[model samples]
Target: MVLSYMEGFLLGLGAAVPLGPINILIMNESVKRYKNGVIIGLGAMSSDITYLFLIMFGLMIYVNQPEILNGLSLFGGVFLIYLAYTIYKNRDTKIDIPIQQVAKKSSMKLYLKGYILTSVNPYTVGFWFSVSGYIAGKELNPFITLFGMLSAILLWITLMPYLVHRSRHKISQRVSHWISLVSSIILFGFGIMMFINLFYN
Candidate 1:
């Protein structure tokens, strides 16, 4: 059981450590505003946990169907493109105001951004599906394995933002501009790739 948990932890850590959309958002937001960054991570993590639970318990089997996956992929592509534009448009944006100053409505918007983005990501959903299938044959306790994965994800989301937040200080508008620009490009590239795949697949 302990070995099973450790293996699951390693798997989760590997998956979460990659520089994907969620990590990218967390990094960019953390540099600008720590609270927002953490909130985004929390929201993303929440979505991840929900998916993990559902997938492991066989509630997400329908998601693997061809039509549904294509729909999700298309939506995810468009969503990423929109986010890229939004980020590029707001490249010079900064919300250095105190945490308390951030409006409740805006906070919820940020959280939703994180949640919806993760949710729509076909890659994330598919990856978890594969992982769950793999574990099913290995005789691992699904709950224990999921707990390990959850712990790994929780650790990443918390520590990652805090580190980025601590390191970035008095960041200039120029730096922010470049960061946003690069992030937008990466996101746009991913979105375009997804769109291209729609026709091929």
Candidate 2:
């Protein structure tokens, strides 16, 4: 069981380590409003935990239903396309908004925004679901595996802000713009793959 938990944790870590839209949003938020940023980060982490729990309990079986999987893929692909545009539009943007202004918004609202943003990412949810199903044969306790995965996700969220904070100086506006552009491209690629997968596989 211990080995199983470790394996699950490592797998989850590998999946979550990739820098995506959520990470970029966290970085931007941290620079502009540290407290709200942390809350948002925590909310995103909470979504991960929810995904992990669903996955551990055999939720991936939904993907085997062709109709459902196709619908999810279509929805996910469209959302990715929209997200790509949003990122592209913000390529030249920086964190200039005051914390006081941000603070006027309720914390719950910020939390919900983060939660919904991460939760709506079907590819991310599907990835965890698939991974959980793959490892289900190990006979490990689901809760233990979930705890491990959540631990790793929380650790990543806690550490990532500091890394972003430190590296901000080295990253110029041009570099940030390029990074957003590249990420948008990557998202577009993923969207294409998902669209193809919806029909081909």
Candidate 3:
């Protein structure tokens, strides 16, 4: 269980460390309003864990049935393209908004946003299912594997906010925009890969 947990945490870190609109939003908020930035990152992180839990709990098995994976792949591809277009269209907008006292949105809302964003990609679900399946196939305990997965999510959510906060200001705005663009391209590539896999398999 300990070994599995460490491996899962490392996997989660690798997945979350990449730059995206969510990360950009976190960074943007952090530079101007520290607390809210943390909140946004927390939201994304929470969402990721929720997806992790869903995958661990056998939701993917159901989703993978009856060509649902194919549907997911198609939807994910379109979603990526739409996200890319939106980002490209708004690439020049200055995002530095002034901070003000406001009612705090529930953490549940943040968690759901993160969860839904992560859940949109069927490939991700498939990947997790494969990992868990491998362990179960090898006769490992499902409960322990779940604990490991949870550990990974905890490590990611706990550290990502601080990392984003620390690094946001060090990079130039142009650089940040470029990073976001690259992230979009990567997402698009994943979408394409998922589409191909859906048909090839």
Using TM-score as the measure, what is the rank order of every candidate, best first?
1, 2, 3
Write model 2 residue lDDT over 1-201, tens digit each, in one string.
787678768876876678775676676655545565667778887887776656556665664466866776887677767767776787786644344564444789668756756776666666776666666777677677766777777777777777776566677777777877886787777667778987887
* Model 2 quality (TM-score): 0.72
Residue-level error in angstroms, candidate 2, position 201: 3.5
**Candidate 1 regions with alpha-carbon error over 4 angstroms:** 94-105
Report backbone clashes per prediction.
Answer: 0, 0, 2
Candidate 2, overall lDDT? 0.69
Candidates arranged by lDDT, highest first: 1, 2, 3
- Report the CA-based lDDT of candidate 1 relative to the real structure: 0.82
lDDT of each: 0.82, 0.69, 0.59
lDDT for model 3, please: 0.59
Distance from true position, residue 180, model 2, in Å? 2.4
**By lDDT, is 1 or 3 better?**
1
Task: Provide the TM-score for each candidate, comma-separated.
Answer: 0.90, 0.72, 0.65
The candidate that wins on TM-score is: 1
Clashing pairs in 3: 47-114, 47-115
